[model samples]
Target: MNRQAQAVILLLLGGAVLRASVTDQYLNYVKPGLRGFLIAAAVLLLLTGAAALWQGMRTGSPAPDGHDHDHDHEHGHADDEDGHGHHSPRVAWLLLLPALGLLLVAPPALGSYAAGRTGTALTAPSDFAPLPAGDPVRIGLLDYASRAIFDQGRSLGDRRVQLTGFVMPGPDGTTILTRMIVSCCAADARPIKVALGGDLPPGIAGDPNEEQWFEVVGVYDARTVKDPVNAESIPYLRVVEAKAVATPAEQYES
Candidate 1:
């Protein structure tokens, strides 16, 4: 490809990595195991760039083809122009950096920031049909959070619940929040805030205002009512045990 195009590619790759390093919000779109793909792509980009630069550098005078072949070459000037247009190297491979970022860390959809900012707790129904009851019910934090705002989460009143989300620390540090999954865009992302209500677990409690995916498996410690909005005010799903785990995508379907 041309030097101009190659230059653009080099800049874009560096920009994408910089964004990924700072943005944990993009955890959804990414799948696990993406390091190998990125490394290979980066190496290929560098090699192609080097080759293009070499071609540009080697534009010295062409060798003479035996005396009077000049007339024959005059018409071929058009061919040179055509070759430059058609055979100019393409920097398309440079796009692989952003692609790798998408595969590696497909950002999580919008989260509580949007919800709290708008004074909304993600849209939920008056009730969710029956959550398949199990010995120790494995529920999602988003499910609990959505239900918390609707006053209909009695379905899980005293049952054991399993939730996976990130920690949102409380003031006391005695308890930490576990948030759940959200798909689609962050404009509607909602976090189920379950307070881990037992002895302090290992690791620093999560940053309250950030996104920290975890797995908090515990029994529902009864529900509590918060500042209700109109007739639809749900109760919180208090938990007894919360073990942090990486976020899962299947928890919240778009």
Candidate 2:
């Protein structure tokens, strides 16, 4: 509540932002393109906090009468009322809690838990081009979904495709491959889901633990199912191979 406390809060918040921006942690909360802005904002906050703290310390010196004097009469009155110069309510300290948590341990990106609750976001119908030349061409989950659902899997053909996403359990004991799509940040993120069918690869048994990342190799299946949450048709993939994979640096698709 005091000038020093306010400045410390700013510094803590600034440090937390800087830490998230400099590392891969920022990807969990925002798009990759916003990293520069986040870094710039953090630097500005740090500078402002440093300047305010220095100014507060410089102006807090005692007068000859053993009473603190401030440059402004309003501040002096506030100091008189609180005795310790605290100018705001004590509840403001609560803002520091999130800052401290961010600095200590950044939260993980949205995964199966979010995917299960959110309905699949299907893009507007558009003509999709043919898959690139590869035995197992890599494809984004949203793109594949669009091709399967709207285009009726014409672009997909018989080529095997590879998709990388976290696992989400679907209705009727089905498995789902999911990725979050975001225009700006995680607050507006929506799930893009594809149901997985067929047998699992060797050494991988049973349904994967929720939220575990995986790279699945499969071909398009004509089967579509209704989403329990939104009743939207979710396309299917007949998986031929699958393996656990590390989470990517940027988890969300733009």
Candidate 3:
């Protein structure tokens, strides 16, 4: 690409990155901790592109063959006559496609469509303490799963709990409460989920494809359910109440 085109592409990509980072939209695809890095990268790109643009305007465009006409070609080696010696490779131009896509139509974050494709269970560590006093203790999906599956539900101990996640359909005609755990970005996101033991009301079970978010108040059921396909331990929750809720500002948990 020519200097002008390269500069424009850089500015656009930097703008897109800044927009995503400033508005908290970056959380949809990446961990919350990456905010600083994204912002730094955007600033650097903008500065570099602005500098290149200024230089391009001052120096004018290159020759059709990408050679500097003002240079002393007469004294140069015979092999330099082809003009291809200093030209950039054509493959570098392909980098513009991602920038254009980001500017025109950004892709949505991974959701139910992604969760259904992968069936690996997420396990938590075994260092949890007893549940504090609360009718319903708000806890993360991954933490609950870890205690339930790995620690054998000792920490839960009859305490009511609350979890928020989207609906994921199970192979046995059941619906699961599911959330994706993102370490750095969407590419590394993995699903953590639990099976709702009792019958779900008509409203909450209405549309599995919609990927509706919900806050479920329930207690852990000691009875462990096993994934027949993978033989992984699946956590279970006995639902006391279920309410439809707005999707959280940050879709994925760290």
Q: Please tell me which predicted candidate would have the highest TM-score against the true structure.
A: 2
Q: Which stretches of candidate 2 lie above 4 Å from their native place?
A: 64-67, 71-76, 79-86, 202-206
Give each model a TM-score.
Answer: 0.47, 0.91, 0.86
Better of 1 and 2 by TM-score: 2
Clashes (N, CA, C under 3 Å) per candidate: 22, 0, 0
Sorting all predicted structures by TM-score, with the top scorer first, yields: 2, 3, 1
lDDT of 3: 0.78
Better of 1 and 2 by lDDT: 2
lDDT of candidate 1 over 55-154, digit per residue (tens): 5444422547544443335435645777533334345665666746654666545544433332224566765767776866765556666654454546
Itemize residue pairs with steric clashes in candidate 3. none
lDDT of 3 by residue, 212-242 (tens): 8888999888766655557676788988898
Name model 3 segments beyond 4 Å from true.
61-86, 206-209
- For 1-254, candidate 2 gives per-residue lDDT tens digits of 77878999999999999999999999999999999999999999899999999988988877678767564564768778977655899899998987988988788888888888889989856578778888899989998999999988988998899999888778777788889999999999999989898996532335668777889999999998888989898999999999999889999988
Stretches of candidate 1 exceeding 4 Å from the true structure: 1-120, 171-176, 185-190, 198-214, 221-235, 246-254
From the highest lDDT down, the ranking of the candidates is: 2, 3, 1
Clashes of 1: 22
Model 1, residue 7: distance off in Å is: 9.2
